[model samples]
Target chain A: MELVVSQLLTGLSIASILMLVALGLAVIYGVTGVINLAHGEFVMLGAYCAWFLQTEFGLGLIASLVPIFIVLALFGWIIEALVIRHLYNRPLDTILATWGIGVMAQQAVRLMAGGELRYVEMPAALSSSVNIFGATESAYRLFILGLALSLFALTWYIYRHTAFGLKLRAITQNRDIASSFGINSGRVYRATFAYGAGIAGLAGALVSPLKSVSPEMGTTYVVDAFMVVVLGGTQSLFGTVASSGILGELSGFLAFHSNDTIAKALVLLAIVILIRFRPQGLFAARVRT
Target chain B: MNLTGKSAQQTLLYGAFCVAILLVPLFLDDAFLLNKYSRYLVFAMLAVALSLSWGYAGILNLGQATTFGLGSYCMAMALKLGTVPVHTGSDGLPDFMVWNNVTELPWFWAPFHSMAFALMAGILVPAAFAALLGWFMFRGRITGVYAAIITLAAMVVVNLVIIDQQRFTGGFNGITDLAQFEVAGLAFDAYSSSTYYLVAFCLSAVLLLSLAITRSKTGMILQAIRDQEDRVRFFGYDVALYKIFVFAVSAGIAGLAGMLYTIVMEFASPTFLGVPLSLSVVIWVAVGGRQSLLGAAIGALIVTGVQGALSESETFLESWMLIMGGLFVLVVLFLPKGIAGAFEMLAALFLRRSAAKVPSVSQPAGEAITHGEGAS
Candidate 1:
């Protein structure tokens, strides 16, 4: 029972990270109609930025989050303006374009950081662990889980209640109709893209301390995020959270008993089988055309 | 008559190109360059397969490396098993397997001892796997990004499997220090410069076969599917069959490449089956020009060559992926057609300018000058 509880906590922490990564991917795909292959690279960039700041200037991990998010948000805007704008309405081209961007970003990181996996020192408070249900756990893991869920709730609230969220949704669902409804679709696109990148940045900053901060670290998570998005229904945020939680927990439990590689292969095979049956992902969005 | 005129020119150009490729070893004395070119040539076969599926049949199989690695592993197993009599270590069973605690060969692994069976298995296993995958995917019309995603997943899964199966697949260390062949009384030492020549000869032969297939009517049908699947279906073509056929053919070529790769490198690792390797293959195709068979081969050569060179350099070497990534972006965004396409376009421009200098009387009826442009 204690083992299960610890597994659940681990699952929740991973799911939180996945949620942040998939949130950006889902939003970009929803609003812009582009499967940005470079989304993972953006997350990597954000993590690297925080790592850089932590190492060079010795900034507080929480304080570094602001700069990471802002810088990535601006980068996202520039990507949208420069390359992604032209790739709109062409899904295949977007895949290719973003793939190019991903490649460039990965190489750039390697070049900048000199190919070594650097360690990020988490703040002492964040590093502390607390006992939960007779199982000792890292407080950092719980904090991340809380932060991610709250962020999702915040995003959901904004999506339902706020003016910007509505506009973003409007633009995504039906661009022509949204334009006709007097919403500036362009501004909504830029904002959503930036917002998505910022969320990914936040996740990266959270997870930087846990994992080895390397140029290629993001690719591994991106694959899992892709599986989550595909399984969860690409456009639905709640579905992403649910799928990530389930998949993460299942894989974590499997890895505990079996080899890590076999566990991953099994999860991938399971996802593929699921996709074969349900071509439209689990919890298909009603608004999806 | 129109077909006859174009095909004749194509035959002549291809024939000349083949001769030139065969003669390349005469000018280049470096065994390393020859070995490198041979490796590239093997990849060229793989690229031809990719073009068959991606360029013609519109199947974006991002897991071709899985098949390539399968073939390499098959060859490595054969070589490993062959060395049992010669290098009989304490407790036998090749050095790596002994270390991993396998006293005897696995029951399924016994057949690879024979060269004939091993070679056949290398090609056929990948073909069988691709056939099964293509059967489901093509039957369901899983094209576009979904197909790409599925194949990408397959790549990750295959690499994971290979990495996990430490005893059979050699884990992350992979299979190395295997003996060369004595097939049909020919003593083939992979380490020698002569072996590189043999590899080069085989590469040219494969290139010829690939070219013939690309120019065939079947190839035209495959390209038509790439352009419009619905239209071909309307015309009563077996769309699924064609997709499977192209995919299987591509897998076979990648298998052949892997076989040659094992012979050249004498090492087959899980890295051969990784997502990065598959993605790099796609990059080669995109950079070379998707439809052109020759272009695909050249693209693999150029990209691999550049990577090899850059990776060797001290200062800029560590950051080589950045350079490659920038190149990928520039090529895709600006050079939509690819390096081969750009070069072809330039050649056409020069030819047009040269033809302009000729008098009006020399120009043929219905304009032969415009034919190359439209066909390309």
Candidate 2:
């Protein structure tokens, strides 16, 4: 019972991180219809952003979140306007182009930061382990779990109620009609791209404490996040939520019996097989063409 | 059929290129340089294989190296089995198996002992996997972005398996210290200049095979399918079979390159099957001009040669990747058709200036259209 409980907690904590990463991915892919191969790099940049702020300015991790979002969103806006905007109508070039951008970003980071792994010291308040129901776990893990759920709730509310959300959805539903209805798709796209990037940045900020910060760190997470988003269905938020949780839990449980690398490989294989059966993913019906 | 004026020009250019390749060893007397050039040829084969699928068939397969790596390891294993130690108690037990404390030879390692089987398996393994994969992806109507993602995921899975099974697969160090590549009582020594001929001869053969395929009626139909699949289906063609065929054949070609790579590089490692190599091969194709097989091969040779030169020199080694990344971006954005495309444009312009009323690019009506690829 203790082992199961501990594993479940581990699963939930991992799921929370996957959720944050996939949330940004799902939104970007949904609105822009881009796989955004560089989305992972955005997360990597976010982690570096947090490390930079904490070291340069002595700001706490919590204090850096807002600034990280703003900076990352601004950075995203520049990239979209300059590069992504030109390639929006040309989908295949976007993949090739974004992959180039991803490589450049990774190399740029490597140049700036060097290749060694860096650690972000966990805050003292959240450093201890907490016992619950005879199972002991890190306080930070629990904090992340709560933080992730709250963020999801906030995102859901904004997505459902905000004017920006409506505008974005309108464009996604029918780009031409929405433009006819006086929606500035260009503005929505820029804003949507910014928002998605901002979310990825924040996820990176939160993730920095848990994993070692490196240029290539985003590669695995991004791939995993893509699996979550792809397995969840391309355009469904609920699907992202459901699939992230299921995959995270399944991977966490499998890791308990086997090793982490094998567990990861198995989970990825399962997702590939699952994709074979339900290419629409876990939630949505086939996209009516 | 008799060749048209444009085709005659293309043939002339191709002959000149092959002659140039044949004469490379004479200009460069250094055995090391000859070996280096041969490795480039192997990579050129990889690039040409990618051009067939991505350029003509419009598959954009992101895992070409997976097939390449599999073939390399297949050849490596067979060669290693031949060098089994006398005191290992069992015949044909690879050194790694002894080091890992395995008492018996694995069943799969058995057939590799026979030279014919190993040579056949080296080509067949990757092709068969691709055929199976292509069937699943194409017949199920899972294509475009999904196909790309699925193939990449499968590659990751296979890579992990190779890494995890350290005892059998040599972990990350990979199968090294491979024996000399021998064929019918003849040895292709790594240090010998003749080894360069072995690779160059095979490369031209593969290149010729690809050119023949692209010119054939089946090649025309494949291009048509790439342009408009639904229309082709309406014309009573089996679309999936053609896709599977091209994909499998492309894999087979990559496998052949992988075998050559094993000989040139003298070892097989996990990096050959990894994402970085796979992506680099795709970029080589993109930079070469995917629409032209010969151009793609040249692209690989040029880009890899430049990369090699830059990476080897101490001043630029650290910054080479960054520059390459920048070049990659510039190519994808501005030079989508690549160096070959630029040359063709220049040639057409010169022709136009010389002959006032001549038509440019006299591709047949049936062979003209090719759609820019995308799922969205």
Candidate 3:
């Protein structure tokens, strides 16, 4: 029972990180209809930014979140304005374009930081494990789990209730109609994209301490993020949350039974089968075509 | 008569291309350059396969490398079986397997001992896999980005499996120290002029066969489907069948290329099945005119050539990746049709001028759309 609890906690922590990464992807994809292949590069950029701040400026990872988010979000906005904005009508081109952008970003980082893995120092307070339900668990993992769930709640609240969410939804439904209603669809799109990018930046900053910070680190995470986005209906925030938990736990459970690579292969095979059966994913999005 | 007149420019260009490919050995007699050029043709074959599926049929398979790697491994296994034990003294089980402590050869590796079976299996396996993938994806109407993602994820799984199952598949090092290619009494040595000719012959034959297919009625239907799939489906054509056919043909071509790659390079590794290689094929196809078979082939040759040349230079090595990325972006941004498209435009202009010189032109510009895609 204790082992199961610990495994669940581990899975939840993994799900939390996945949630952070996929949230931004889901946000951008839902609103703008652009599947950003460069999303992983943005995550990598965020990790680098966090690493730079923590090492050069001696800032704590906890202290670097807001600034990193703001910076990367603005950068994402600029990218949206420059490239993604033009390719809105062409979905296939968006994949190719973002792929180019991802490649450029990856190479740029490699040139600057070099390919060596950089480490982020975890905060002293959360480094140690604490007893929970008669099982030892890392405090950092618990904190991350809490952070992930709360962020999901916060995102859900903002998306479902706020005025910005209203405008975003209106534009997503019908661009011309939304514009006629005095909502600047362009600005709304840019903002939504930036917000999504910001959330991705937050994901990178948080995950930096847990994993090795390298230029290619984001690629691994992005694949998982994409799976989450696909498995969770693209337009649904709640679906993203639910799918992340399910996939995270599935991989965690499998990994516990087998080796890591085998577990991943199994999870991927499961996803392939799931997608074959239900391409719309686990939850259907309630949207007007 | 109308077809002959329309394809006059195309016929001339194709003849020149064939001559150019055939004459490379005469211009560069160095054995090293001959081998490199042969490898370029292999890459072009991959690009052509990609164009058939992605450009003509509009099915972007992101896991093309999976089929390619599988094919190469098949050929490698067969060739590995031909040779007796190097150090094993354990009755010919492949050096890596012997190293991994396998005394007896596995059943799966038994059939590859026959050259003909290995060759057939190389093409058949990838084609069958593609057909299965197509049945699931196309039949279910899972087109566009979802199809691409599924293929990509599937490939990653295959890559991990190969790497993880090292004892059977040679793990990360892959099947190395491969035996020389021999059939009956003929030895297709990598550095030999005959080997280069063999590759050239294969490349040319595949190119011609592909051209014939793309020019046929089915090819027209595939392109029509690419433009407006729903319209084609509404017209009572089985969209899934056409897609599956083109996808399988594409996979077969890629598998053929992979087999050639193994023969030329003398090894097959997990990286052959990697996402990066798959993406590079996309890049090559996109950069060459995705819709043009010849363009895609040329694009692969140029891109691979440039990469090889740049990576070797001291000053350009570090910036090579940046240049490639920049080229990819610029092509996507301004030149979506690619360099081949530009060449086509120039050819069209020349044809237009020539037509003006002789006023009695029977065929109208309506056939230009069909014949114009022939090549530059």
Once superposed on the true structure, which residue ranges of model 1 sit more than 4 Å away at CA?
A176-184, B1-3, B84-91, B191-194, B211-218, B234-238, B308-312, B347-376
The DockQ-based CAPRI class assigned to model 2 is: medium
Give one digit per residue, the lDDT tens place, for model 3 in B229-292.
Answer: 8889999999999999999999999999999999999999999998778878989989999988
Write model 2 residue lDDT over B1-376, tens digit each, in one string: 2368777777777777787888888888888888889999899999999999888887888789989999998888877776746557656577777789987888898887887888898899999989988877787666666677667766766787898888889989898878888889998887667888887887788888888898888898898787777888899999889999999999999998998888888889998988778878878988999889899999999999998988888857777767777787788777878888888778767877797666645534413442333323
What are the Cα lDDT values of the candidates?
A: 0.77, 0.83, 0.85
Tens digits of per-residue lDDT for model 3, A1-289: 8998889877888888889899999889988988888899899999999999987999998889899999999989998988888777667777888887888888899989998999988878899998878788888888788887888888888888999989888888899999999999999889988988888888888888899999887767778888898889787888999999998898888889997788888887777667768878788676667
Fnat of candidate 2: 0.34
Single out the weakest 10-residue window by summed lDDT for candidate 2 chain A.
A270-279
Q: TM-score for the second chain in candidate 3? A: 0.91
C-alpha TM-scores of all predictions: 0.90, 0.94, 0.94
- Local error of candidate 1 at residue A51 (angstroms): 1.9
lDDT of 2 by residue, A120-176 (tens): 767779989999778999998888888878877887777779998898878888888
Deviation in angstroms for B114 in model 1? 1.3
Q: Each candidate's DockQ score against the native complex?
A: 0.41, 0.49, 0.46
How many steric overlaps does candidate 1 have? 1
The most accurate candidate by lDDT is 3
